[model samples]
Target chain A: MRKLYLAGAGNVSKNLLSLISNLNSDIKIMGIENSRGQLFSEESLSMADINNFMKSPEDYRKSLNISKMDFDIYVDMRTASKNGERERDDYINLMKNGKHIVTANKSGLANFFPEIGKASSEFDKKLYFEATVAGGLPVFSLIRSSFPSFTVDSFTGVVNLTSNFVMKKVNDGMNLEEAKRKAMEEGVAETDMTDDLDGTDSARKAVIIANSLFHKPMRLKDLKYSGIDENNIKKNEMLLAKISMNKEFSVESRVFTLNSEDPFLRLAPMGMACSIGFKERNPVYISEDMDGPLETAGAVLSDILSV
Target chain B: MRKLYLAGAGNVSKNLLSLISNLNSDIKIMGIENSRGQLFSEESLSMADINNFMKSPEDYRKSLNISKMDFDIYVDMRTASKNGERERDDYINLMKNGKHIVTANKSGLANFFPEIGKASSEFDKKLYFEATVAGGLPVFSLIRSSFPSFTVDSFTGVVNLTSNFVMKKVNDGMNLEEAKRKAMEEGVAETDMTDDLDGTDSARKAVIIANSLFHKPMRLKDLKYSGIDENNIKKNEMLLAKISMNKEFSVESRVFTLNSEDPFLRLAPMGMACSIGFKERNPVYISEDMDGPLETAGAVLSDILSV
Candidate 1:
């Protein structure tokens, strides 16, 4: 049996636990943690228990008798921005301890790819993060498994859900504040929307894709990215956004004007799409519908099974 | 070094050899065969030599000095329908002789999957056929690597290029004969187009996908499929075609009328697309551009690398 340690007790983690608890018997949840600290469970955590723990992890941190860090797989689903560095450190420690990792956390991979990647290779542990971009779409996994058979000259797509949602709403004649508010109400955008609007989220995904798909190490800070400034959208006008990598492996990510027939333009609100061009064939297009929290959980589950 | 044997010297085989000769160094071609007989090469077969041999295999078969059947992988790219059972026997013989198999041939799998699959597992050898569906689109490969991660509730797509081409041409106001003639002239349809228009090709692909993806022991004869009969179409009529798997793993493939906005209706001319719906999330749509012999070779190469 493979022991799995979860690093986040949020909705994504809960959903994954719920999925695995019912379907998969080979993998068991050994431990769980949040901002406060950690809690251990030899038996698989029940959905109600996971919910209770998510509601208040600190309450159980002091009561659980077992506190083991030894696990076969470390699943990182934490999304708190402030805990980014700590989460990275936790991942590094886990890898150093010979633990395989599956993550939906983009910050760790996009920001500390070299260190995490180095540790993973040095320890010879499997590291999977298909959920980092295009939640549950299998974009990254598809490239990793298929690119060996063909020559990919470049790739382009809409990897950001929040910006796409907001931009789509704006295109439908909604005001900036109204669109953002609607997105937030629909759980499409986080309360702190700077990351999405400022293009940080998309840039992080681009960096991860570059590193994983093209084997190019790109930093989010060094990437040239422009986000949708809702102020720029005129009333009832259309807006288009896309992220692309050129033949030189140079990355370009921004919102721009494009014809409706463009493959990138077909992306729906909160949907992610990618077009990979090969040397002698027409481009391969893959896209997923609106990515919700449950979808992110689905991606996380996909990684867990893959690892 | 891994030795790879070619069982056919068709255009697809030639393209794979070209790709492997240029990109991959781990796999080296040791022998090749055509309809006449087999030829051996001490070194990798050059593109010019391959072309010349393809033009007149009997001449090369008579002149080649070295001949050997011992190889690590047997690449079957032969498309002769009359050689179907013979090819199946060859595959079983090769597997029994401890050789892995990679094939672009559909008749063998669509007809003799049980025996081949049993032989492969019994001998502990790999048998890969990623090129069997959607040309070089990696459809089967993607499903193999990723579907195990999630619950694939159902799948639907256009898996036949010839039928898609014929239908698109028919929709473009061409008569049945004109459409078929144009498809054949473009090499999109086989000269004997019965397999494609009669839905045998698509049904074969469906059997392969069902057997491979869902682990269902399905046969071609058990499947109900309908192909495009140009006589059934009226001028300026919109025709929508798709291959879909239901929740019970039963497959439904036919041409019907769909809304203009349906993703199933958005297929390009000679392009193949599939939408796979999971248990909880939206469907994942993957499509490839117009497939030619070169693309089929790309798929075969993908299998070679994977094996």
Candidate 2:
């Protein structure tokens, strides 16, 4: 039986915890952590206790005695934030402790690609992050598992769900402020909404894609990106943001408007879409018509099963 | 290191052999068989020998001294036909001999699922056929790898490329015969093209998808289907055919004309597309803009690596 540790008590983490119990009876959740605290158990946490723990803020992370504890896998489902930096450190430590890491946190990968790579290799720990970019759509794994022999010509996608929602609303005649407000109300956008609007989120996703698909290690700062918030367009200009990379494997992401007749210009408001082109075959298009939360959780669970 | 066997000399199989040499040096082709003949080697087949073996067909299959031979995996990339039953028997025998099987042949699974499933489990062999339905699209593996916990609500797709090609051509102001001829010229449709035009091909694909995605064991005879050839409609009524299934997990597929504004009706002539809905998340769309040659080979290589 595999023992698992979950980092973060956010909606995605909670959803993942709920799923792991029902899917595989042999695997047990050994611990859970959030910004406020953590709880560890030799026995699995009951559903009621899992929910209660999500709401509770008591720190019991150290109770298990980290140096002496043993678990097979550590899943990080935390969102990108300053808290994520600390989680990233913990992830490194967990890898050193011989815990296989599965993550939905882009910040963990986008910020520390080389360090994480070295640590995973040093400890012989397998690290996977399918949820980092377009988690709802299975683009990364498709390339990794299905089309490894094909030479990738290009990859382009609308990776940011919040910005996509805001843009769709703007196209429907809502002002930018109202659109952002609506995205927040729908629980798709964060309260600040800066990451979604400023292109950093998409840039981070682009970096992950470039690294995973093209073996091009890129930082979020290396991307040439421009956000949607900085632009003011007329009614005719309906802008959408996408992260794009060519055969050269350089990540270039920007917000732009396309003519209506372009086949690739179809957009979904609260979803993610991507097209991966190969040298030997036609492009593969993956489009997800869902918000981020459930898909993120699903992607995390997928990585868990993979590990 | 893995010992591999190629079970066909068709375009897709030949392409796969070409790719395996470049992609992974650890995997070696131990044998190859076609209707014309077979080739066997204890050592890896040289590139020259592989090409020569594909071109030369002098029956040496039984000469391998079956009782003395050993191989780890068998990949069946043969197209579905009368000869396929013999190949299916070979698959069963290979599994009985402890060879894990990967296939692109729908007939093997669609027709004899129970027998194949029993043989695989009884012998503890894995039978994977990711290249069976819409081999150009990574739908089955995507669902298997990406969404493990989500309950599938529905699966719908334009599974047959020939029918899609014909429909696109008819919409472009060509008669059915002309459209079919065009598809044949493009090598997307068979020379006879009866299976594609009569919906039998799509029905076989539906059976595969039903079994793989919905866990519904269905056969070609179980589906309600009508081919494009049986339909007669006005030129103004542009028509497209798609295979569709709902939460009932029953296969209800037919060819029909649709209203112009239906977004789902839009399709590429040489591509495959499918949308999968789940209980928790919104629908995920997988679109493939190519036929089964390179993509099918890619899918086979994927299953090969998986084993």
Candidate 3:
């Protein structure tokens, strides 16, 4: 049985718990690891044990998080920045003690890589945070593990859900307020969507990635930030549709190509795109990929599993 | 210092040695595992060490004919059919006795999975073979080590360079022989391209991947085979270019897409894709974000400095 030390009980953490509760008998995920450090049973935690110790792999996995659940790896999906800091310190200590860590929080890596990395080397424990940048996409593992022989030249993306959502709506001929209204309702734009709209979120993702790709790290403040809102408007529904269908690389590449097709120049307040940023280290351009959920989630899941 | 046993020094084996020899000091890859077994290194060895007393991750992997290298992992890159019964049994005994086995050799997994897996479990040894499938990219660590939570849908890709090369040329107007000749000259097609074009190469790679992903024993013959040939193409350069950057959807709902907009893809002998494979098991995929060999040589030089 593996015990998970879940520091936060947010939507993602709860979802993760739900995913694992019903795993096979051979691999049991005990209750959350808390400051009290008490473990819980499946019934006590209210999570199902789908494996039944003898069920088939597919059935076991469908009912549970994975047919072969390995909760020996701990997960931390906290959204709080302060908790992210605390979690980083805790990871350092745990790594020194040979404990493995899996996290959805990007702030963990953005904040404390050197300390966690040194301890991981000394203790040989795993510290993975693939979910920090991309939502549910296997991005980190692809760069970190699979292609150990390669070095990244640069990273750029079309990040910022609010910016993308707002721009996308604007291109469809909707007014700024109308787009914001729809975005807010659809959960596409946060009530305080300013962070995403202003390119702060994408900048954060960029720096974290720069650090992960190479030993030399970059800071969020060092990036060239931009955003797209309702200013530049002349929608080609055909172009948008083609781009969405992956036929046109124009807008896809436009996310980071500053001074040329800059999304921020076309839109503002409700959208943003921070072009490539480099400060005293390797240059990288981190933006967004795809429309929903973000690529960070899948990557975090993959990184955590490396343990 | 890591000891490696190259059971068969074939195409992949030679390539792996070159890759390993070029590694830095942090990990040492000596020579083939059987250098001592052969008794006379000068006769059978390429990079034979005179004093073989040192055994561990501390030895320098400063030995290679095709390149300079060192490795801390054992890699078997031979085909199963090439390995004799004696070598097969001997390899099993080594694995059973707690020696690590890292190989892309089909027979190793086809014949010795259960026993070796049991032995690895008991001894806490690892058997890593990232090159077994998709020399195009790394998938083993991605699935097995990176994402333990997600259920893999299935993998699909243009795994055979031979077929890809043939199709590419034929699509660009070259005849079968001309395409094959060009491929062989470019080292893109195997010396025996016939097998790959016929789909046996893909079968081996798929089998190795399936065996690992499912954790259930299966053989090469278990899979339903598919192949690509020159006859499938017509003379259409524009369409050829468009198809070269293709995408394949997996049963898992994830899409595998490639971009040939880059110059390297345009110059390559074949236009191909290798994607996530495995059903009801966890899967791994590569990212478009990753940069391959940002000047491959410089990276290796830096690795040497690290060692």
Candidate 4:
């Protein structure tokens, strides 16, 4: 029986749990530290609160009359690292104890990749987190598996869903605040969904691309992220209409913005970023393949699949 | 004979040339506007330039010593509508004559999707651009295929390769100047790659995506684009190593970043955008019956084989 441990049952975490029932029968959950409720229907080896379990696991599990649980992997589904002290240590501890770690918890990895890498190195454990960057997007494996012949100039994309939804609302003519509120109501975004506007999410995703695909674990503080949620674009409907994209086609992608702008003229109104594969004044479409934001993600997805 | 009338001899046009050989042997290139250098093969049809041929079809084809060359599909692969004054009349003219348009050009359809929809209502001319927003990504079909039951929340990715690369170079320690030069020299970039930097590239791709996938053609100007230029990054090799990604991964799907900072305590790093699926985030993978990015592309390749 392949025992697994899961930490922090947040939105994404809950989703992961629901999928576990469809998991290969070879895998089973033995422990989880979610307060909200159980996500995966595994035999609870330790139901004690994370705080108590982190400080002393034996006592916590003992109360439940469980002696020893065999967990092959640990999945951390927490979305952020703001105040997750025990969640962090507990995950680390599990990994140190010959257990692998797979997570959708991008925040945990972003802040502690180097240290985790160091520990995983010493402990000889594996860590996988495909859902960290893009929820369902296959980013990690893209870089991990690719064989180089083709050079990667850079990578960029809408890595943050909250902001993505917010941007979509703004394009739909809603004010920023209203758009944000709507995003949260839909559960696609949070109160702090504005963080995407600040570019922190995109930048964080960028950092991961840099390290995972480029073989560089960058310092988050060093990155300069500018979000699309700035004061400049309040509600430019005409521009939005002309450049706005229809939302009907992108049900999976769920993008809401117009992309029609005069390329010959120097005026640009779409969200974008850069990398090493472009120069001169290429058209946006051409530049996308030659120098667009989604390249790294595309490449990494490809890479991961090959691997 | 199955013939394809290639209109513009730009990237898609040229790329299509390469693709023709891979098609069924019965397919042929009946009327090429210009007898320019072969994109891949030396064999082709009417080699008259578009404008010149349009001016005096008989004279031009006569010059080439042709008896008859009736085209079934007028393949237009010109710069996007975001470009300068395109001859919309020419496209309409082709459609009026019952010629279908297969294009990678966004402007023609994006600029006039509604008009085209209305006109095609009566004319019954089909227009297709499989390589628009994310080249070779099957964006339009994906949306058209997955309708009503599915809802799109946001569409975001490293849409422009030039920008992705530029950011990669900046993270690599090369100043904007150096990265741009290298990109051009590498043939991974376009002549006017700078246009990619202004965010227009992504905007255009986004617009096309919005229109084709979402049925909402967004004006590029309305998009709140945020570009990552080199003035803000370092040219240090060490830093580059810290935040490096490869092109192969990004070119696959979305999610291409060097280091993804996790909101949760940094547990791991993975790039590639993921959408919330019914069960897992990689729903596209599952729904499409593919496991990951490699499978996605591989399946497409297989479809080509089966076809």
Fnat, 2 decimals, each candidate: 0.60, 0.83, 0.18, 0.00
Model 3 agreement with the true structure over A1-307: per-residue lDDT tens digits:
4445454444455455544543342333544432222333543333433223112222322232211333355667656473246756767766655468787766666556665666777878777766665455455664554434444544444445666677668867798889888889876666877766656665566656656654544444445655553466444311110011112211121233335333333432332222232221122222222323322334544554445
CA lDDT for candidate 4: 0.44
Quality class of the docking in candidate 2, CAPRI style: medium
Poorly placed runs, candidate 3 (over 4 Å)? A1-3, A23-75, A82-102, A108-127, A158-189, A233-254, A257-307, B9-74, B79-90, B107-127, B215-217, B222-226, B232-272, B277-307
What RMSD does model 4 have?
19.1
Interface root-mean-square deviation, candidate 1: 2.4
lDDT of 3 at B306: 22
Per-model DockQ? 0.48, 0.73, 0.13, 0.02
Q: What is the TM-score of each candidate against the true structure?
A: 0.85, 0.92, 0.63, 0.40
- Write down the lDDT of every candidate, Cα atoms only: 0.73, 0.72, 0.47, 0.44
Shift of residue B273 alpha carbon in model 2, Å = 0.8
lDDT of 2: 0.72
lDDT of 2 by residue, B1-307 (tens): 8788887889898778777867855888888877777887887688788778766676354464442366788888765764246656877888887789888888877776766777888999888888887776777667767787887767777778887688778777898778878998999977887777777777777777777666666666666776664346343222222334453446755665556644455556687877787877788887876776777888888778777
- lDDT for residue A18 in candidate 3, whole number 0-100: 44
Model 3 residue A295 lDDT?
Answer: 28
User: What docking grade does candidate 4 earn?
Assistant: incorrect
Task: Give the DockQ-based CAPRI class for model 1.
Answer: acceptable
Give per-residue CA lDDT, model 2, range A64-128, as digits (tens): 44534667888877656642466567778888877898888888777767667777888889888
Best by TM-score: 2
Writing each residue's lDDT as its tens digit, candidate 3 over B128-181 gives 655445443445554554555555545554445666667667767788889888
lDDT tens digits, residue span B1-307, model 4:
4456655554444434444444344555666554342221125453334334445444543233221246566665554555423635556666777766666556655455555545554678776654444454334444322211233434444445565565566665677788787768765467887556665555555555555444553445544554444465433211110110122111122222433421111111111121222211222311111122232222222222221
